[model samples]
Target: MIKFNQLRKVFDDGTVALDGVTIKVEQGEFVVVLGPSGSGKTTLLRSVNGLVSPTSGNVRVNDVEVCEQSLRMVRRKVGMIFQQFNLVGNLSVINNVLTGSFSTYNKWYSNLYIFSKELRIRALAVLDRVGLLDKAYQRTDELSGGQQQRVGIARALMQQPDVLLADEPIASLDPMIAYNILSLLREISAEDKITVLCSLHQVDFAMHFAQRIVGLSEGKVVMDEPQKDLTAEYIRKIYKTHDKGLFFGPESKPYSDDQLVTWSEYK
Candidate 1:
């Protein structure tokens, strides 16, 4: 469902985000990208949806050339979720979700009128699927962090995307809330047959939910293995845990959401 060939992304400051990376994903498969800070995971995900254009190489999603296609066209079919829940603070929960359906709207009606009945009904159903239908009328800023994240997922689903790209989606929530969100994502992947490419920092959760894990470090793929074939050594290399002491004894670092949010200092 997705393909990347020699993809490279260099920022304006000459920082290379993705370095000649190439990968492919099949339809209906859930893959987890594992790496510490500065890896190419975020660049790769944005490239698939045309949010971050590749400097050279090609990115194809569902057989369409991502770089060549219009961003609106690619985004309509490829959904993305961020670590921070991206929603309009003033808009109602349902309205934020309806924004996701903007791609399916007609130029004339969407510009002059409100949402159509068909789109409204579909939005409600998607909100229900994400367990946020009852909160539809509430303002988005009124929601708890976890509920807001769920709102983000519901908004993405309303797009009816063929591929879902989640960039450290659960990194902001507490462990229990994080688990709930991950489980919901997994359920959606199974029931909807949506291809999921989620980047995660939590090793245990990635191993638990993802069928295949791809590890990147220093802008390169260090380990790509099925869950059953992975080990501690492989994880350590990707995360660089040797001198970090995060995996040490009882006094070691704890896996807190705050730490995940403040990733610039993970080392």
Candidate 2:
């Protein structure tokens, strides 16, 4: 449902965030992007939803190119979850989720603090899905970190998106909370048939939750493999080589240069 071909993103400062990357994610598949800091993981995710335009090449979602003309429609079909739960601290939890429907609401009504009965019902249903229905009336700032992120997920679901983009969704939470968040995402992906492209820093989380793993290094794809075919040793090698200090101690493994597979093979 998503495709990137020879995608390259070079900033005005001549910093290349994405370098000749090409990838395709089929409908209903859960793909995890793994890379260290500055590896272009966020750039790749942003490109899909037109948040960041590519310097060269193209990005397509459900056959529609993510250009200026198609951006509004593209965003409607794509949902994003961030590392920091981007919620309005002063707004009620339900109101925050309701904001997702602003794009679809009538302009005159959109500015109003009150939402329609039907929209409120939909937002409540979504909050329930994320186990936050009880907190709907409470201010978002009063909630815990995990609860806030759940609100983020609920807000994204309010869009009823065909594809979900999670940029380090669990980075700030404790490991257990992170597991819960990812498990919820997995359930949503399966039950709704939503294609998910989630970027994560932890290899173990990627292995446990993703059907496929796409490894990136220095803005380039180094490995794309089915989770079943990905060994811990292989993951360690990717970190050891392209990621270096990104992984250390027991997580790092020793491997020779010949063991590293060519990116073209995955292509």
Candidate 3:
């Protein structure tokens, strides 16, 4: 349902965020992107919704290329979750979720933040799905970190998107809260058949939740494997020694340079 062909992103400052990367994600598949800082994970995710245009190559969602002309259509089919829980502090939780429905309204109504009864009902349903129904009338700022992220999920669901893109959704929460959030995402994907492409820093969480894992380093894909074929040692090889902190401990088996596989091999 999503495809990236030879994608490359080069900023004016000469930083190449994505380097000839290519990847395909099937419908309803939960794929996790694993990468450290500056590995192009966020750039790749943002590219899907045209938030970041590629310098060359292309990104396609549901067979439609994500260009300036197709951005509105592509965004309608894609829901995004951020690590920062992007929400207006003063807005009510329901009001925040209502923003996702702006595309469905006329410009005047949308500009006035005037939602129809049907849209309000739908927003409430999505809030309920995220276990935030009671808090819908409360201010978003009063919620806990985990609760705020749940609100973020509810807001995304209000779009009724076919694909969900979560960029480090669990990066800020505590371990248990993160686990619960991941669990909720996994359950939603399984029940709704939403194709989820999420970027994560935790190897163990990705291994437990993702059907397939795509590892990146220095703006290139270093590993792409199904859960059954992904060994801890193989994943350890994807990260350089200095970069391997919590993912790999000192007792883990070391890998030789010859054993490493390049992105070209995947082609």
Candidate 4:
């Protein structure tokens, strides 16, 4: 459903975020992007929906060139979740979710403020799916962090996007809350058959949830493997030693570099 070929993202300040990276994601797959703080994971996720355009290379989703076409339309097919739940604090939960369907409204005639009854119905349904139906009428700022995050998910689901890009979706939450959110996302993907691509800080969480893993370091893909085939030692090389849980550590296993890499999958 999504493909990136020779993808390179270079900022105006000469920082190359991504370099010659290539990845293909199938429909209905749950993939995790694992990396350290400045390892280009966010850049890759933003590029899928044209939030961050590639300096060179191509990003195609559902056969549409993300860099070439109108970003307004591309974003409709790609939904992004940020580490911070980017909710409008003053707006009601239902109204925030309503923003996702803004594209369907006739912008020429409406100021994107006047929502139809049908739109409201759909927004409520999405809120229910995220377990936030009761909070629909409440101000977003009044809710807990976890509830606010659920609202964010509801907003994304309202778009009916085919591919979901989560940029450190669990970074802001506690461990239990983060697990619940991950489980919610995975369940929704399984039931809806949507492609789920997420960047994660916790290695154990990714291993437990993601079907496949893509590890990045210094703007390059160093490890890409099915979760079952992955080992702590192999994950170590993806990021430098500073990345603890990702490599062999107290939580991870004692991995060694001698374990042969699965090169056939890359081929």
Best by lDDT: 2
Candidate 2's residue-wise lDDT over 44-102, tens digit each? 99999998999999999999999999999999999999999898999999989998887
Candidate 4: residue pairs that collide: none
lDDT of 1 by residue, 1-267 (tens): 888888888999999888887888888889999888788888878888888888899888878898554667888888888899998888889888887777887766654437888888988998899898899899999998889989899989988998999999998899778888989998999899999999987766776778788888877777778866556667667887643345332345544332322212322
Stretches of model 2 off by over 4 angstroms after superposition? 232-237, 240-267
Model 3, C-alpha of 204: deviation from truth (Å): 1.2
TM-score: model 2 vs. ground truth: 0.90
> How close is every model to the real structure, measured as TM-score?
0.88, 0.90, 0.90, 0.90
Candidate 3 vs candidate 4: which has greater lDDT?
3
Candidate 4 ranges beyond 4 A from true positions: 108-112, 242-267
The C-alpha local distance difference test score for the whole of candidate 4 amounts to 0.83
- Pick out the ten consecutive residues of candidate 1 with the lowest summed lDDT: 258-267
lDDT preference between candidates 1 and 2, better one:
2
Clashing pairs in 2: none
- Model 1 stretches with alpha carbons more than 4 Å out: 107-113, 243-267
Model 4 RMSD vs true structure? 5.0
What's the true lDDT of residue 149 in model 2? 94
Q: Which has the better TM-score: candidate 3, or candidate 4?
A: 3
Q: What is the lDDT of residue 153 in candidate 2?
A: 93
lDDT of each: 0.81, 0.86, 0.85, 0.83
RMSD of each candidate? Answer: 5.4, 5.1, 5.4, 5.0
